[model samples]
Target: MFSEERRQEIYTIIREQKKVKVAQLAEKFSVTLETIRSDLKYLEGEGLIKRCHGGAILGKQEIKKISKFSDSFDISCLLHDLLIVRERKDRKPEGKVCVLGSFVVDIIANVDSFPKVGELINSKSNSIGPGGKGTNQAMAASFSDAKVHLITKVGEDHFSKYAYKYLQESGIDSFTIFQTEIEPTGSSISYLADKTQNNITATYLGANNTFSEQEIDISLPYVSEADVLLLQGEINIEANIKAAMFAKSVNKIIVLNVAPYSEDLKQLYATLDFITLNANQASHWADIEINDINDATQAINVISGDENKKVIIYMDELGVVYFDGRATFHIPPMPSLRVDTMAATDAFNGAFASKIAAGGTMHESVLFASAFLSAFIEQKGVTAMPVLSQVQARLKSRLEDIRPQIICNEKRCI
Candidate 1:
């Protein structure tokens, strides 16, 4: 029974001041400590805040949005019209995604409940799917019609072959898919329940941990050639920083998706073009309390700053919070049925990058990504990503549906 309005107000206060005690919050809101705890629990669940020993801190995300529009498109007078024209053919970018991070085969089981520790519960259906933050991000970029160059390691095993061939067939580059024989390829074990809550696992490193700085040096050339480099935290932290610096040196846009909450990501923030994350990762890394959805903006601004950096906070069904230098956009989720929550952010980043690469502004890119992701979530897995034309079609259809409701008032009709 936590009110979003109350949660957001308290969260905003804490974020502004950097700390808020239970007494302060309760005194300000006239609520008991127990009620405040419930609010904290809800915020914690959304990945927006952390409950410290006593008070709370701003989440790790500095959500900043950048203004990428030209003078013609930057005017607030044109925003409504802008949404309609976003699907125009002028905004498609084609290059390739140089993905840097881990790759693994995801094994998902749909089950009713966990068996006793010593026993087993059978599943209604199971799947051997392509995933891992890096791979998923690569697939997401590919689905946006960008050529993808994946830099990862997998065991020289059957799963590696399957993953490689799938990437190849789907048109992702495999030049950097190095192999190792020391252990099996990494795989994630997941158990999905009827409520959509699930348990997941990652095997200890496996071949993915084998990637070294030397290997990153070898791939620096590719990073230079690509328009953008997408990175995930699952890789060795040092290697990731090295690659980010290299890409930045060449003026390549670096987009980071920091997951798994590695303590080693201290320097990753200052070097990114955009950092997308769930609420908790933002809270954990940025030291913010995200008690409500709107409070996400405060967390985001803390991580990236009120400067030119762009930080996208993907809050799942709550939609996305984008902070650019000029403004903040709280775009609600496009109504759609979500089959699986995995890989959606990757799809968002891929499409967003494609829009930027194609010379669209940040606003345009986010809108495209939002709509594209809506489509992906409606289907299941990475295979749901559509080609550029299909994405446009969906946008067109959605916009057309809303156009009639917007009366032009004669003066602005044209």
Candidate 2:
């Protein structure tokens, strides 16, 4: 991929000469004609240049060579466009993702029993981990090889710095993060009981609750620049609504996950490109009685009126049901152990949105998301997300592994 600087350089030469030969560009850039040809093709697609016989000329819509520093906004726009073109141009940045929601420090512990008045329960162990809906989803998108940016607020303390550092190392771009003065960072305290069900969670909103309209306005450029913007309901209801509206204003696809359901979800649903929620959350958001997949489908159908908005009802083991317009389908969950249900929905949306940005259709996106979540749930924590290749490989292998079983079942029918 040609650097935006280099692309600007080529544009400069083309502007000065009005016409330039491929060999000359190759010489000036100290590269091969093939490389110059590739660059010219990119510029041409951008409506920047016209390739002539053995040479190229400025296109009908001429662009002045703008300075890198002077045209910062324009340059940023070009860089973003170039990023998209580069993905299509050759191999490019995997897509840009914006994750808006909770950034929490998860404190996991194993305890004997609930402490009675003066009685104490022995604490087996404790570990501090970064776990938040926004960060987790951003991580999943990154693991799937997308260029993700997390738009979250955290305290101006050690936890915030640590969160920023963690995200930076994981390939999430740090430029899009928002840091505010303390009001402590958000957190969750979980305690496991025996080896079965657990008693967990008292979360601190901290700076997460302070996400203001001003901050959201400032973050709009990133949102608008992104191919997809994922919204989590961890922030203020007004903020979520504004962010969804902002995304819609810019024509960026919005994927809203109404987890931890809220009273204002109906207002939110009409703005989303896709809405993902577990059976419980879906049932609650749609305000209908949903006991099974069929009921869930009917509920979604009623709420998603005119088929204008798409809905993805996540039915745990039964899989995910998708309805957009007249089309309705379900992608069944893969057979895998469910160790931790936390972040599973985030994994689904992250992978699903990433796939869509990577040029996958609705069906492909949902299936890929379902496959990723199945593998994700089988693992324990945040780092459990599989790569795009790994998910695809697992999907392929699973199919092959089941071929024999399919044949046996078919034989029984025969």
Candidate 3:
């Protein structure tokens, strides 16, 4: 058998038995002792198993322990401590998700070159469509075959009408969208330089940033109903924090996609079940310069803060780095001709949440998200989320691997 297959078999054995001797593996696989040792070494190196003198043991996931001094009155953290002791409902990884985030209409303008300050310039092309980190992420999860319920706000205007129309047909299982008459619908101006394809977006908070405790309380049912709650930095921090605290109370998995780097989220959001962010956000969060893997590692370690945190860092068009407290793995970029890079982060975040909800291991979820990303980016807009076949094809051709098709809601997947 190939080495990869052999290693996988050995890994299974160690996982089932919790320990295995080198000699036993060699005899079982009809391989030499050296081969068995090599397999054990590789598995240990991959953090799947722990090598010992004459055998290996399955690696244990070291969950960070909540301090005893933590107040019992702090019900959320107290409940979370209890949560780790019980069996979670979403073991199949195909569970429901609730996204407490924002949706904005994106106005993208392309230019030959960035104009000088205050100098008027003409655009080569322009387009308007549905785009927002939250909207994109929820769509990705829906496309990944997860049943998603999005909780957000929009203005009571023409844009709001489009928002309602879009979500009504967007395949997201449900949405608790609030229409505020005071503020205009959330919107952004994106300038894309022709040469570099680089972009700068300025967003008007509008109704997106007006979430209140009352609204969050109203959305509590969706928060409690979902197996996983996905959050981002784009929404109102106070409201999202309350939503998160509620999710924690009910033992839901919390995943934060930190973007637009906010100082308030640095300490609190990092403690979530999964925290995924791009390199720029990581640099700001960890207060470290991240130019390469080593630099990224330092930033991850700093953000991890000596806990067994599941932290992932993405460098656009470069690759994804996942640090699981103990070790870090570098997942290579999914090769694709970059089109609109606007929603890549949201795509990955949403896909990752779906896979995690489906009970895939962190590595497997990363692989799945990586494949989804390659498929998502080849297209131009967030609404251009590829179907299962397209993602499966990307998994076959681009990622060079295939797994069971993720199916949910009778017609969606990752």
Best by lDDT: 3
lDDT value, candidate 1, whole model: 0.68
Cα lDDT, model 2, residue 102: 77
**Deviation in Å, model 1, residue 295 alpha carbon:** 1.8
Off by over 4 Å in 1: 1-93, 112-120, 197-203, 306-308, 399-414
Regarding lDDT, does 1 or 2 come out ahead?
2
Clashing pairs in 2: none
Q: How does each model score on TM-score?
A: 0.69, 0.69, 0.72
Task: Report the poorest 10 consecutive residues by lDDT, candidate 3.
Answer: 405-414
Query: lDDT scores for all predictions?
Result: 0.68, 0.70, 0.75
For residues 204-247, what per-residue lDDT tens digits would candidate 2 score against the true structure? Answer: 77888787777788678778778998887777787788888888
The candidate that achieves the highest TM-score relative to the unseen native structure: 3
lDDT for residue 1 in candidate 3, whole number 0-100: 29
lDDT of 3 by residue, 18-63 (tens): 9899999898766789989988886665556778999899777412
User: Comparing candidate 1 with candidate 3, which one achieves the higher lDDT?
Assistant: 3
Pick the winner on TM-score between candidates 1 and 3.
3
Q: Model 2, which residues run further than 4 Å from truth?
A: 1-92, 110-124, 192-200, 399-414
Which candidate, 2 or 3, would have the higher lDDT against the true structure?
Answer: 3
